[model samples]
Target: MNIEKARFNMIEQQIRPWNVLNQEVLDMLIVVKREDYFPAEQKSLAFFDTELPLPDGSKAMTPKLEARILEELALKKQETVLLIGAGNGYLAALLAYRARHVTVLESSSDLRDLAIGNLANNHVSNVDVVLADAFSFKHTGTYDAIVIAGGLEQVPEQLQKQLNTGGRLLAFVGQLPTLTAQLQTRTSGTDVSTRNLFETVVAPAVGAAPVSHFSL
Candidate 1:
């Protein structure tokens, strides 16, 4: 397969139509070599417009969705980022290019090792991969941006508190069959503003707080 051609086709066909127009983001999508992060058996599906499964049942977000999140965050070279659900470290690799530093939290040991190895092999020095439950991990410092790389019924307020004032968070919120990809921005120490960016369904973050159901 012609990898470069496949990459271009993915950007032009799948991502661009989804409104990912940022030149830098488009360029990074080309440079990131996403195939490097996929499991060897799944490399052929690296650019496909669907979620790719990872070890331990986690998933890499679709290319267009990843691009959309990156564009929405508008990361700065001076900003620090926190990435939840660092499945295979693909998104963390992407975030590393834009932010000054990134801290990735993963629950599975196998995935944590996979992410660490992939990032190191790619020479991504700015990201720190930690094996910890996203819901229970305590952060020592706040971040300029936080991206939860999966769907959630609701983002816990405790997790939201990890953002610095003026920081932004991207997550897919809601249940299966319907979900909204929303960006929550910390307007102040105590205030947050949310804007729905698009609609998509993704696997839930491992160990995410489950939604309550009331049956009649």
Candidate 2:
């Protein structure tokens, strides 16, 4: 398990083939060590093309899916991001590297602590991990971008409303056996455009209770 070699293989084989061709994103993926974000037991899966297990009963998103999400979001260096469901803080660290700042909302206290510690360990100082559930938590501040890192029946409109003008959001929408990764952009006031990225299944969020606002 040559770490650097495995990471290069992950980028060249797993992520690149998925259409994640963004150069800045690829570079950030290399700089931010995903392996460092996982626990010892999950470190082996760091560069694998699958989700790493966390103790909160939720899985970190797969490498390719995460890359694709970042690719689509196209984060600006000065943009602020809101990340829902921080898994071990890996994704938040990635977001922090690309964006000016990131605010993570996590329901699981353990996961929140893990995210805070991991981000600190990784030298990511632009992220704040808050112990809050996205399903019930209220977002008062708007963001330049938003990412829902877990599966949801449908993204609530309230969350969508939290997006600033020209903001982008990436999320895995739908339930088991069928889930689609979609990116939404706030084109204008109260109006959003959506694009379907890919299809995949992931575990539910901390307080997932799906409604029905998605059609892909």
Candidate 3:
């Protein structure tokens, strides 16, 4: 397979058309080599416009979604980022390229280890992969940016509290039937502003707060 051609096609056909126009983000898509992070058997699906399944039953976001999230965060070179749901470390690898450092939280030990290994193989040294649940992990310091790699029924206050004033967060919120990708900014210690960027449904992160159902 012509790997370079496939990569280019992904950027032009899948990512760019989805409105991910930032030149830097488009460039990163080429530099990062998404195939490197996929399991050997699934490498063929790396450039396709679909979620790639991981060992722990989680799925990596599609190329367009990943690029869109990166564009929304607009990461800076000196920023510290907190990433929830480190599935296969592909997103963490992307974040690491744009941010000064990244701390990734993963509930599944198997996925955490896989993430560490994938990042290491790609020589991504700025990300720290941690085995911890996203909802319950206690952050030692606030972050300049935060991204939840999977969908959640709602954004948890615990995660929002970890964002520094002026920090930005990106996450997909809502149930399977409908979900919106929201960009939230911490305007002050107690105030946050949110804007919906797009609509898409992704599997909830493991251990995410469950959606309550009331049956009549």
The root-mean-square deviation over C-alpha atoms between each candidate and the true structure, in angstroms, is: 1.7, 2.4, 1.6
| Per-residue lDDT of candidate 1, residues 42-145 (tens digit) | 88899899887777776778899888989999999999999998788889999999999999998899999999999998899999999899888776779999
Better of 1 and 3 by lDDT: 3
Q: What is the alpha-carbon RMSD of candidate 3 to the true structure?
A: 1.6
**Candidate 3, residues 71-174: lDDT per residue as tens digits?**
88999999999998888899999999999999998889989999999999999999999888878766677999999887788898888888999999898887
Q: Which ten residues in a row have the lowest lDDT in candidate 1?
A: 207-216
Best by lDDT: 3
Task: Identify the candidate with maximal TM-score.
Answer: 3
> What is the model-wide C-alpha lDDT for candidate 2?
0.86
TM-score of each: 0.94, 0.93, 0.95
lDDT accuracy of residue 8 in candidate 2:
95
Candidate number that wins on lDDT, 2 or 3: 3
lDDT of each: 0.88, 0.86, 0.88
For each of the candidates, give the backbone clash count. Answer: 0, 0, 0
Q: In angstroms, give how far residue 105 of model 2 lies from its true place.
A: 0.3
Error of 1 at 49 (Å): 1.0
